[model samples]
Target: MNARGYFWRTVQQQEVDYIEDADGIIKGYEIKWNPKLKLKAPKSFKEAYNTDVALINKDNFREFL
Candidate 1:
């Protein structure tokens, strides 16, 4: 994943599991295979990006994937 700080900060030095572009567009996926698996989108994700995050977890894997 690619991330950049706002307010004229230099390029970020860490990698993330997700990424959002300058226009706040994000790109990625999450997959849960176990029948009892549970997952939630991160708060930072919604706070920093645009577009709804997609969840590909066990409860609705087929329909989502």
Candidate 2:
């Protein structure tokens, strides 16, 4: 089956770097270009949408990719 979905910057601008998906499954992603940089996800990200939210760092970015 084929699914379609999209993710956008919320009004709060949680600072999501990117999002990836193949079906209806929603995956929230945060990309940090800098290895030493720090990123944080907004609380509303998970509750606002019925999707999975994750923080993507240099260490585990492959999992999300």
Candidate 3:
């Protein structure tokens, strides 16, 4: 299925690097260069949209690609 989506950036400067509409389900992702950093999805994005959020860092990026 072809998915349509975009990055969610807010006035407060919080951002989700990518948001994808996979069929009817939503998915959110945050990319961080630091593999040790533990990051969560922006609060506004999570509260506004129902999605599975994940942090993609140097260590586990291969899975996404």
Candidate 4:
């Protein structure tokens, strides 16, 4: 688990449910309880750091775990 902050005078924050550094690559993930809700990684985080993002929910959480 990791929390990141973005600052440009005023500060903004984003939390990733899980993160891993594999071989030199950074991956980001978000977990949601609702499978029906379509979600994506935060735009600020994505734009700042180009990396893989994933959504874990009831329907597909098993595949991730």
Candidate 5:
């Protein structure tokens, strides 16, 4: 299946850096420069979608790939 990428942000400023839509399945991503920084999917976004958001950093970015 083909995938399309998009960026999402709400008027209130909640955001997900990247979103991948593969057919009807959705995936969310947030890129971080520092591995130690705590990153998580926004609460509003998680409440709306059943998908998990990945926090990508140098140490473990390849694992997601």
Candidate 6:
């Protein structure tokens, strides 16, 4: 694989599912199986990395693909 690395992060109970190093771009994801549940953005990640995190769920998983 050409990806640089697969990363995981956690700050208390908040977390990122993974940060995929695709080529040179770092993509962050948080996944929820239940679309109806509320999803909170990982603010610490944005503050530390200056990157936005994407959410994946049953309702909108196709877009992530």
Q: Estimate each model's TM-score.
A: 0.39, 0.57, 0.83, 0.66, 0.87, 0.70
Which candidate has the highest lDDT of all? 5
Best by TM-score: 5
Tens-digit lDDT track for model 2 on 1-65?
Answer: 56444565777665455655556566777677566765576667667666666666778877755
Candidate 6 Cα outliers beyond 4 Å, as residue runs: 11-13
lDDT of 5 by residue, 9-47 (tens): 999888999999999898999999799988877988777
State model 5's lDDT. Answer: 0.89
Rate residue 33 of model 5 by lDDT: 77
Runs with alpha carbons beyond 4 Å of true place in candidate 4: 1-11
Among residues 3 or more apart in sequence or in different chains, the pairs in candidate 1 whose N, CA or C atoms overlap within 3 Å are: none
Which residue pairs collide in model 4, if any?
none
Each prediction's whole-model lDDT (CA): 0.47, 0.64, 0.85, 0.66, 0.89, 0.77
Deviating ranges (above 4 Å) for candidate 1: 1-27, 57-65
Residue 2, candidate 2: Cα error in Å is 5.0
- Poorest 10 consecutive residues of model 3 by lDDT? 43-52
For residues 1-65, what per-residue lDDT tens digits would candidate 1 score against the true structure? 55543321115432233433544545544455665645455555455544445556566867843
What candidate 5 gets wrong by more than 4 Å, as runs, is none
Worst 10 residues of 1 by lDDT: 6-15
* lDDT string, candidate 6, 1-65, tens digits: 57654556575777778787876777788889898877677888778777888878998999887
